[model samples]
Target: MPSRQWPNILITGTPGTGKTTHAAQLVEALQSSPSTSSATWEHVNVGDFVKEKGCHSGFNEEWQSWDVDEDKLLDELELVQQAGAKVIDWHTCDLFPERWIDLVLVLRCDHSQLWARLEKRGYQLNKIQENNEAEIMEVVLNDARESYAAEIVVEMQSEKPEDMEQNIERIVSWVQAWRADYGG
Candidate 1:
């Protein structure tokens, strides 16, 4: 492996915006490259990591979700963050430190498209509506911009299959460029 650190890319967005899909594709693409063979690329799903690692303090009755303690989660992810080359997929972005993340891809979907995707997931009507509203409002994009430098944060549309492919290609190119510039 190169002595230079690899990038820690965060794929964050409103639920059902295809963050996981992008993350998985990114990992697969990177792992297939001979240049990146020495580098370790991990797809860290924050929601599942939190649950499996017991990083949350408690569960939320209203949302029916775990109340993730930012500090605890960070503590638990310390080693992974330090290892780098991580594709961190999560709905929230601001909790992760700016220094640890090299790129933030805030995936966005059209309100109607996002609504249908969430609905297909069997999400409650209220939850679906809430996520749709968040997408319409560009909450995740704004949060990513606020949490990371503008140069490091990108807002990409993922409403269609082509959009997702384009995103994956763009990030793959980015990784190639980064390796060329920084890796041995």
Candidate 2:
């Protein structure tokens, strides 16, 4: 594939909203079913890379450490640009350059469901409440929308995996269409 035909897909959402899960599912689906042409799928997590590198000073004093410096993230994104047609997993979509992002999938979850998911993850009550409220307030989703073009899609994930799968399928088809339309 040509470099100019790269398709960058951004999968973002509030905490516990299934962004990573859906991103993984999308990658699997794409890889399992080969496209008519030479298109390929890659999944990149900005947060995990950041945490692995210990790039953030603010997180050093935390009880559990997960830090990704902004500068380091930019450096990693350079690799994603070259990878082409990849699914990016990160909490903050606006941090990336708009020129490289083609599609933004913002996962939204119900407050009660989100709280339950966080609780299941062993988060403290305060942390659960904070994430729930942040999601309800649309802090992350709004940030993605503000930074990207109007095509930013808002997908909802309920308490069931089936619900999540539906959204994933929708995104998969969207990616297929984009590839067809944009000459990817």
Candidate 3:
């Protein structure tokens, strides 16, 4: 890995764990910070991209299936390499190449809070139940560990934005330290 080359940091978690919010916060912070300016950062939300591009359709016509192209995404990883830093937002981490990732932040949410959030979205009972159960089971964290090496960090996020801010603080400092120690 080149020192000046951008670092790809993945922020993954179950739905309603605030992955998107945290990703946006981290990206904004990096762009505004003046400490180190060798690279730019971008937040890529895989699901949003898939939905926007209309990638896959399945049994539920209302809900398009997510069929991620790992190779294509890995090729896009080169964009982060060129930018020198990125905060990737995605629910699933196993889709990307582990070698290309510098760090993984797995956001976690309590099952009750997650269920409430999902309910607000008006998801079908079955989908909500499935997601709630997944959160309770720590599916996201398990998936991250199963797919990646031993450096992933897991943090919990409450329903409140303040809690999300705290989570972002931890990540911002982590990013700064990683860059200081690993960057040129």
Return the top candidate by TM-score.
1
Q: What is the TM-score of each candidate against the true structure?
A: 0.94, 0.86, 0.84
Mind giving the per-residue lDDT tens digits that candidate 2 earns over 26-108? 88887776561266777787677676666576664333446557887688677657656788987678788887777888878
Model 3 ranges with Cα > 4 A deviation: 1-4, 36-38, 52-59, 62-82
Clashing pairs in 2: none
On lDDT, the stronger of 1 and 3 is: 1
Q: Rate the local accuracy (lDDT) of all candidates.
A: 0.87, 0.75, 0.73
Candidate 3 local lDDT, 46-132, one digit each (tens): 777655655434235444246555566556555544555767888878877776687888888878888889889788777788888
Could you tell me the lDDT of residue 154 within candidate 2?
A: 60
Which 10 residues in a row give candidate 3 its minimum summed lDDT?
56-65
The TM-score, computed over Cα atoms with residue i paired to residue i, of candidate 1 is: 0.94
Name model 2 segments beyond 4 Å from true.
Answer: 1-3, 58-65
Q: Candidate 2 versus the native: TM-score?
A: 0.86
